[model samples]
Target: MAFVAMGVYGTLSAPVRPLTHGWTLFFFVFNTAPIIPMLGVFAALYATAATRAEREMEKEYQRAENLLLNILPEPIAARLKDDPHLIADEHPSVSVLFADIVNFTETSGRLTPPEIVQTLNAAFSRFDTLVEKHGCEKIKTIGDAYMVVAGLPEPREDHAQAMVSLALDMIDAAQEINESGQFPFSMRIGISSGPVVAGVIGERKFAYDLWGDTVNVASRMESHGRPGIVQITEATRGHLGDEVQIDPLGDVEIKGKGRMRTYTVSRGFAP
Candidate 1:
């Protein structure tokens, strides 16, 4: 499309005839008609270009949000998107679960690094599914250890119950792996419920983590727990309903936190 504006200056300057002036004006108006169509075409192209740009930007924004969600909880990820500042919140009540593969170091010695990673991923992937199924948020994984929590980043009335169910599912998942005879590894799990502070750390490669006495105790419980057992603190035990079966392990000495009563649930859930 092209817009050509005819100059009345050349004709007007050359010679002006009163009778021909009206004809000159009419011809000028006729010549400008093509310009209207040219302007319309330009406007349409601009609008199309703008719409495509907006769609591309929206897609990029969605991709960024998904990446953030993978790193943090949905609520936390939204908060981060609103403000990139440090995110720290104190949760008054939450149940944290820690699970570690028993004899990982010894087992790893028998396999290649790639093989160990593959096996660990296979086991942890199932645990990840259980975490999502039970409405719990996965905190992070350290080596052979997987950490998860219920209630915080979002609140739930039955955090402990959700945690117990997830722990049992994890146990069942690990058992299935062992029975498969492919990189068999028993899991030791520990759980604690109380106050905790959750936050995003590091300016680069930020990670969501939990801190405070509750997390520490949960970690200790896992480290001190026996293989193939789901050990839980008294705080967590109080939340488990009659539907679950637990074997009492009275007042085991915990490092840093004196003697605390603990229990183990071998198999859970009612028929």
Candidate 2:
């Protein structure tokens, strides 16, 4: 219609007077055309702002995610996003290590709850750093006990040794804590290597967990073993080398598992 109207006006006004040629042609055909480019500019500006906003939101999400990563396993974190109510499947070839402050019950029982948390936090801070450094996923913490593992959400050949190294560092940390005379308590670490299943256990919060004989054995090693010590099963020993010196603990009879071969790792780096 604009074109038709321009044409009609051009023809009629041209004959009306000879003065309607240059500016008349320009105005008639493009009366509203100048606004198009301005609208295009506005759209571009809007799109750029939207993109920037999206990027900012992504960064914030990642920040919170990294904080969560410090606590929960990556696989469990992913599951929490998709199906926060779903269970995580078990992954084989996983190694679980259980480490705890010895006599923590007695120690914490003597202090206030806040003091217990503070002392535990001081100990756990070092443990958590070592866990992340060794690429192991922290399973959970029960009072003074810190559970950890390797080769889940991914796998590695030396998970057993990896956990062993972390356990060594944990023992050193306990000695430091003792020197400080905070509690003068020792810590025990037990590690077992084998297949296990892991997943979220409940709905309120995402809890990354493990199950199977591997988990149970790891706990047993912790319980039956001595303080300031790292114990491993024969299977774990098979996967490790002399970098970790071993003591001939021989086969020890554990509840329900009958007699099982076990060893005490006496020498190892903070590796």
Candidate 3:
């Protein structure tokens, strides 16, 4: 733009007619005449560039939103885009699950770090597949523990059954992993059914997460569970009914959760 302005100034200031009385200058008003047009052209070019950039940004934002919807539910993703609020959703009738590698610390000690990670990923990958198949949503992973939900973002009439089925599938998947290879990692899963607030956090690159009494109770169930078992709270047991056999685990003290009656789910869901 500066170069063009200089060129215009040079041409416009040149005199239209030779100077009178032997004045040396030939170029005059014409040299300065083109400067305004040069500036106008530069301004037009800048505006065009800015518009194109804005269009690109909008496209990128849309793509990100589409991916977010794929990972999360539609309503949640929309809330993330349309509103500036923390995207927490509370579902009073959903089932939550938590799973961890059985004796992860001891099992990890036997394998190299890479091997340990590979084993965990393989197991969690299978758990993810099962969760998806059973119409469940993956909450997140805290190291060796995997958390999942059913009928949270979107409602499902048989969320408890679906959750139990997912837990059974995870057990079967773990058995397959144990038999297929030398890795000796088994799995334990815990579940709870109640209300929780689920949402995404932060302005840039947010994560879909959940909270509430139910979430905390579910975590406690996992932390105080037996290996290769699916321990559940009374709340979830009530939802499950007699669909799956339950072995009463009696009332157990849970840190920050008080004394809660717990039970175990044995056998797979019958057809």
Query: What is the lDDT of every predicted structure here?
Result: 0.89, 0.83, 0.83
Candidate 3: minimum summed lDDT over ten consecutive residues — where?
Answer: 21-30
Which candidate achieves the best lDDT against the true structure?
Answer: 1
lDDT of 1 by residue, 21-100 (tens): 78978999899989999999999999999999999999999998788888899988878878999999999999999999
Model 1 stretches astray by more than 4 angstroms: 1-12, 15-31, 83-86, 109-114, 268-271
1 or 2, greater by lDDT = 1
* lDDT digits (tens) for residues 161-203 of candidate 3: 9999999889888888889867886787889998888878767
Q: In candidate 2, list every pair of residues with a backbone clash.
A: 90-197, 90-198
Q: Which ten residues in a row have the lowest lDDT in candidate 1?
A: 1-10
Ranked candidates, highest lDDT first: 1, 3, 2
**Estimated TM-score per prediction?**
0.82, 0.74, 0.72
- The all-Cα superposition gives candidate 2 an RMSD in Å to the true structure of 5.8
- As for model 3, its CA RMSD to the true structure in angstroms is 7.0
lDDT for position 145 in model 3: 86
- Number of residue pairs clashing in candidate 1, backbone atoms closer than 3 angstroms, sequence gap of 3 or more or interchain: 0
Error of 3 at 186 (Å): 1.2
